[model samples]
Target: MFDIDRWREIFQSINKNRLRSILSGFTVAFAILLFTLLFGIVSGLSNSFKSAFADDAQNAMFVRVWQTSKPYKGLQTGRTIQLKNDDFNYVKDEYESKIQYQSARIYKNFTLKYKNEANSYSVRAVHPDHQFLEKTMIDEGRYLNEKDLQEKSKVIVIGRLIKADLFGEKPALGKRINVNGSSYLVIGIFSDEGGDNEERLAYIPVTTAQMIYGNNDYISQINLGYNPDLNLDEAISFGKQLERDLRFKLNIHPDDQSALSVRNMAEANKNVGSFMAILYAIVILVGSGTLIAGIIGISNIMIFVIKERTKEFGIRKALGAQPLSIVWMVVQESVFITTIAGYLGLSLGTYLLSLIGDSLEEDYFIKDPSVSTGIVVGATVVLILSGLIAGYIPAKRAANIKPIEALRAD
Candidate 1:
């Protein structure tokens, strides 16, 4: 029902106690503001982590060799562990169905040049499968294929940043670039969202890299993507099994922790995921706590308002006003204050978060930070519920006031 009389009374009450009403409203607004900022901060942290490790797939795993720390099977403690191309072949042969993609890399730091322009970038020799594992996008031409690997072709794919720097307005396709004095034909251009670092790299056939770098059968790193059916923790266990297998076949000591290391992207993702969950919980608890404090303040003020209006409420009763009317008046006013004040805070908070979110550079841990519509709607609903509770008891007291007793008081 539209209650003009009740609304007029609410406005008159606010007009009379403007300072106190504003102060009460400020409490609710501040609580909402604080909560909004906390939510955005947590979102930023999550985005940062995802960007930081976006270079690899969540199910990806990598293995690198190091010097053995302990002697085993009559081998010297100081013996260096070296993996061969045979290791990659073994996995592809045995676990072909279980794996999604795999690649072996041998990298060399090269001062690459096209005519007079030059840039120092890391050049990696990789399998065609490496393209999918790195999640790289092709801007032009084609990536390294099996033919390039088998024939050991002197063809290279440059990153987008490299193409822009070296080729400028000219097309990079079919052009020849020099890497440490050796000329290689540019076959493709690639790009990544992971920032300029990934853009500064170049990819070539792994066979050619191994041959040219004088590292026959010696890969610097082995990276692979396994079944997506496995979750973060399950994928970690999957990677551990491969690590153990490689150690056994390569004559590396089982206990030689330093001799071999397999880094599981799934494990990294799980830890970050757990931390993000914790942060989300903390944001909810803290936001709820702050809002609750403001509700308490409103409840306290309503109690005081009821006390001061006791005589007025009694007079209304004497004049034949219904108890429900008195209760409703109080409740309506509380709801209005809560809704309006909380909304102002919500708007301010959202604006600030949007500004911050836009300015936040996409990094490893943080990405775009915007509040969902559900959160905004939910917060408003919470405010309205809190208002109803804050006003109920005080309104009930006002409704119950006796006319004779109220009149008898000073």
Candidate 2:
């Protein structure tokens, strides 16, 4: 219901105590602003950390050769631990049936030349099965196949960044690019969520890399992923077993510091989850503390407002105004102030978040930083609730004033 007279009364009250009302409103606005910014930063960092695992297979782990750090039986310290084709075959023969994807890469520094332009890139020789393991997405053309590996084809797949740098806007597929003066047909252009470094590397058949770069069955690293159908517990168990199996097969010590390095993404995610949980708790605690201070500020101001309006409330009561109406008036004014201030804070916070989100480059640690709609809505509800609760006691005090006591006031 539109109550012009009631609105006029509320405006009169605000106008009379302008400085006090402004201070109260500013407190609420500043509190919400602080809370929202802190939360958005935390949320952005969380998203950035999660982005690292994007498009990657579940329970995937990578293994690389590591030199011995401690001396053991018949092995001296500082000896380089080499992983070759036989070691790879041994692991595959034992675990191939249970493995979802397994691959090894032969990496070398190679210069790629096209049309008189030369650039150095990480030219890696990879198996046909390595595509799925790396979560490689072919934007155009095709990735290396089994046939390419068998025939040791001189074909290379470049990243989008490489394509932009090397080929410009022209089509690159089927074009022969020189790798150290050897021609390799551009068979594919691929993209990955693993960021620009992963994208910038050029890929060729693993066998070709071994023939050209490696004298024997030398491999740089081995990668594996669990079957998709496996449950989380099953996947974790198999990953552990595979780690042990590989170490045992390689004759590496159980406590060897550098015999091998296995990066278990599933375990990393679990640790990240724990860290994020702590972060969430910290955000909530800090936000709640600021919110409480704002609520207290509002309640203090409302108490003063009620005291100032004591005579007015009494006169209204004597004039047959309902006690409930007086309470509603007080509560409504408090709600209006807090709601307006909170909305301003929320708008400014979200605007800042949008700006930061657009400008920030996504990395392994932090991505787009912003609060969800639910958090905004929740904050709004808190604002309204804080107003009502802050006003309730003072409203009751105002309503309890007898007309006789009010009339006696000078």
In the range 283-363, model 1's lDDT, one tens digit per residue, is 899888888888888878888777777888889999999999999899888889888989988889888878777566544
Candidate 2 residue lDDT tens string, 1-410: 98999889988988898998899888888888878888888888888777767756656778887787877777787778887888778778887766777888877888898996789999888887788988899999999998998898899999988898888999888899999879999999999988988889899988888887645788988888766677656666777787787777776777885878777776777778788889889888887887778778888988888877788888999999999999999998888889988888888988888877756644324477888989989988999998998788889888999998987765
Superposition-based RMSD of candidate 2 using all C-alpha atoms, in angstroms: 3.7
Backbone steric clashes in candidate 2, count: 1
Q: Please report, in order, the local distance difference test score of every candidate based on alpha carbons.
A: 0.86, 0.83
Q: Tell me the TM-score of each prediction against the true structure.
A: 0.86, 0.83
Flag regions of model 2 displaced more than 4 Å: 47-59, 85-100, 193-196, 211-215, 227-240, 315-323, 348-369, 400-410
Best by TM-score: 1
* Displacement of the residue 55 alpha carbon in candidate 1, Å: 2.6
- Model 2: ten consecutive residues of lowest lDDT: 358-367
Could you tell me the TM-score of candidate 1? 0.86
